[model samples]
Target: MADLDAFLRDLAAESADLEALVADLPPQDWTRPTPAEGWTIAHQIGHLTWTDEVATLAAADARTGGTTFADLLTEAAPRVTTFVDEAAAEAAGAPAPELLRRWRHGRTELADTLRAVPGDAKVPWFGPPMRPGSMATARLMETWAHGQDVADALGVHRVPTDRLRSIAHIGVRTRDFAYTVRGLPVPGEEFRVELRAPSGELWTWGPADASEQVTGPVLDFCLLVTQRRHPDDLTLRATGESAAQWLNIAQAFAGPPGAGRKPGRAG
Candidate 1:
């Protein structure tokens, strides 16, 4: 329970930080292009808003034995490869104030709905089902990742916070998913991940005796896993061939493999 509270609080803080970045932007700035190809600042927020609303529906459906989310996906599948992009583009058409309002409202609703989920009950998602706490952590990761795109568009350098620990955790946990999604063999050996956190603490994962290792700054690891920064632009060091290749294709988000940033596109 305490952990869930902490995750929820961190999720809220992450959202608030991103909101602060764009809340006061001039209307014209909302249309500014972000690093995401063909997506503007408005599209970024819109994507977050749409995902949050869908998450809220999934949580509500789980809590009530409804199949709204499953049905929607089934109906859209085999023909709607671009449903996510379509949803974001549709939401981006709203005026800035309206878009902001919808985003704020949708996130609040999602947080509240997640809190109301019964203990240990899983919520359906685009990927695997997750407990409320895990759901909140994924939300935080996405918020931070998309916030990076927005920050790049605005040329703002966000101060890295310990909240990044959640993203790093996801990055490490999703190692096998990163491989399996690409039709590649999942490595049998565990990879040791040692990242120096912003507060100068060492965040370690996997067994200390693991043969394969990845060592780097936590921010760089997070950016690499999120596909926000190209591998060449990060300072992460991989000690094994598989581990080295993983860096090139790592993605924390669920979907098909992401078209990660090009080399030298650090933002």
Candidate 2:
């Protein structure tokens, strides 16, 4: 079971680590394009800020049982891509220091809001309302995913750590989502997944002897699912056709299918 407090603590730690990386970036680096094509570091932070605010609203709706929240999400659904493009453009225009400040404050408030929700409550989201624990884990996953883009853009190497267990956990949990997003029936057979964490502890999900399985370093698995690293670049090995097919289109985040990192693309 997921613990709200533990997830929140991981969120804070990840946020701080990314902030450290962003804080010292040279001015030129701020405007440098990250791996996310056309998006500079400014746009990355800006996007995170915009998303943090949007997520806060979702949590607030969940808290108060606001009647119109779903309607608003529905209306916003069709234009989600447009909204992101617009937000990125607008964010790019802001000064880097201001952008960082907004993101810092927004994420803190989001953590506080989630802490108040009952552990069992399903919070409103773009896909479905999620329990507070799942919601916190989702936030942590997003932070790590976006942070990868920033790190890649600046040519910084992030040291892998056990913190990735949060992301790996989300990735493993979202195995079914990867198929559903593409209108495919989720395979009924659960694949045994074994991951070697940064701390060198073995992490296993599902049964020990499932016919299908995925085995690899936890960092690589997280990168694969977050769409940050192409399958070819990682050491992940998948047994069985279903597991192989999943690695090709695995998306840890919600919404539609993502345009994952291209094969042989430099990051």
Candidate 3:
């Protein structure tokens, strides 16, 4: 696991980078359709902001001694889903500046809270009680993933950095999230992942002797796992059945299976 302080800093930086890209968009662009079906840029950002609030509540619940982390997620799932729906509806026609302000404010609060939380503090997630560090990393993964959709829709590109370590961590650990989503037993074997970061450095995880391997550029791998970019659209190369199959349903963040966009639809 990554050092908690470093991970939180990376998460905060990535969120700021993503927000900067959309903060000055024209009002028309805010309403432009994204690769996500029936969702615009506003919807994507609103979803991120909404979930940040949920994280806050989950963290609070964990500290107060009310419910198990799993139970907290189970109870809050429907409410968060509904909140995202209502937020998207409300922001559908809001001005670009107002939408940007709201996103920034929400994300700022989330980052601050994440940094303040102790590393070992457990927080409610879809499956287990994640440490504060792990949860912060998960949030970073979501921001980067959704930011990809917004960037793709706007014809911009994000040069992902080594900070992607946080995302890579979640992607590897959440292999079970993929299995659970498909109603399958979690694979017993680990797989090796070898990726080239945007800065051209290599990042690897899992046992080297494992029968599976996922290799590719860091950004492409992130995009693929997040379901923001289809694996077929990127340079990801999976060797072995388990690795390939895992790639098909990889999701680092918490949530039900997203209605993943089809290949070539966004391009």
Candidate 4:
């Protein structure tokens, strides 16, 4: 079982870190365009805020035996062609201060509600249902990924921290899902992944003696998996054809294939 408390704590830390980045920005700076096409720094934070609200609703519903989360999705499905972008765009229209306040409150509510959720409860999401621990990790992964966009837009270089382990973990865990969603056959054999963390500790996944392997610095791997950096811009090495192919399509987020950053875009 996951250490739920630990995950929640890390999620809080991640949110605080991102919040610090934008909290002091002039209101006009929120309109700065990020790497994501047509998305401003406000859009990045807006997306995170909107997602936190949705997750809070899901966790609360699971705890109280309510179906508002599912019902809302069912109702929105037909009317919204791309709900994620729509939500972000709508939230982005808010004044920067108001948007920041909403994000802060929404994330806090989500963390509190997830704590009250039963240990085995599955929370409804855009993809499969997730346990509280998985939900926290997912939130952290996104907070970091989108935070990267904000950081890049501001030309800020954030030092890698151990919190990235959550993103890296999800990147490895979702390997098969990456393949399946891309309409490609999942690799038959396990592929080894070995990443060296910022603290100089090694974090590894998959079986020993695996024929295919990926090895690199943890930061580069996380950037690759999150599609924040083009493959050519990363130092990750793939020892087999399967591993190489996996690198091309790797995505830590749960969604359709992402339009990864173009080469030379990494800062």
Instruction: Mark the regions of model 2 whose C-alpha exceeds 4 Å error after superposition.
Output: 67-75
Ranking by TM-score: 1, 4, 2, 3
Candidate 3 on 1-267: residue-level lDDT in tens?
A: 347667777877887888887887777778878887778888888777767777776676656654644575566568876655676667656676776677677766766665566555677766577777777788888888878888888888677688777677778878888889778888888889999887878889988887889998887777777777666787899999988988888987666876565787553
* All candidates: CA RMSD (Å): 1.0, 1.8, 3.0, 1.3
The TM-score, computed over Cα atoms with residue i paired to residue i, of candidate 1 is 0.98
Each prediction's Cα lDDT score?
Answer: 0.92, 0.86, 0.76, 0.92
Query: What local lDDT score does residue 59 receive in model 3, on the 0 to 100 scale?
Result: 71
Model 4, span 1-267: residue lDDT tens: 358889999999999999999999998899999999999999999999999999999999889889999998998888655888999999999998899899999988999999899877899988789999999999999999999999999999998999989899999989999999999999999999999999999999999799999999999999999999999999999999999999999988887888999999853
Q: For each candidate, what TM-score against the reference? A: 0.98, 0.94, 0.86, 0.97
Clashing pairs in 2: none
Task: Quote the positional error of residue 262 for candidate 4 in Å.
Answer: 0.5
Of the candidates numbered 2 and 3, which has the greater lDDT value? 2
Q: What is the lDDT, from 0 to 100, of the residue 40 in candidate 2?
A: 86
lDDT by residue (tens digit), candidate 2, 78-196: 88778776787797788888888889899988888777776566788776678877888888888888899988887879998788998898898899999999999999999899999
The segments of candidate 1 whose C-alpha lies over 4 angstroms from its true place after superposition are none
Clashing pairs in 3: none
Name model 3 segments beyond 4 Å from true: 64-83, 91-93
> Model 1, range 4-119, lDDT digits (tens) per residue?
88998998999999999999999999999999998999999999999999999998987887999999799779656788888999999999899999999998899889888888
What lDDT does candidate 4 reach at residue 161? Answer: 95
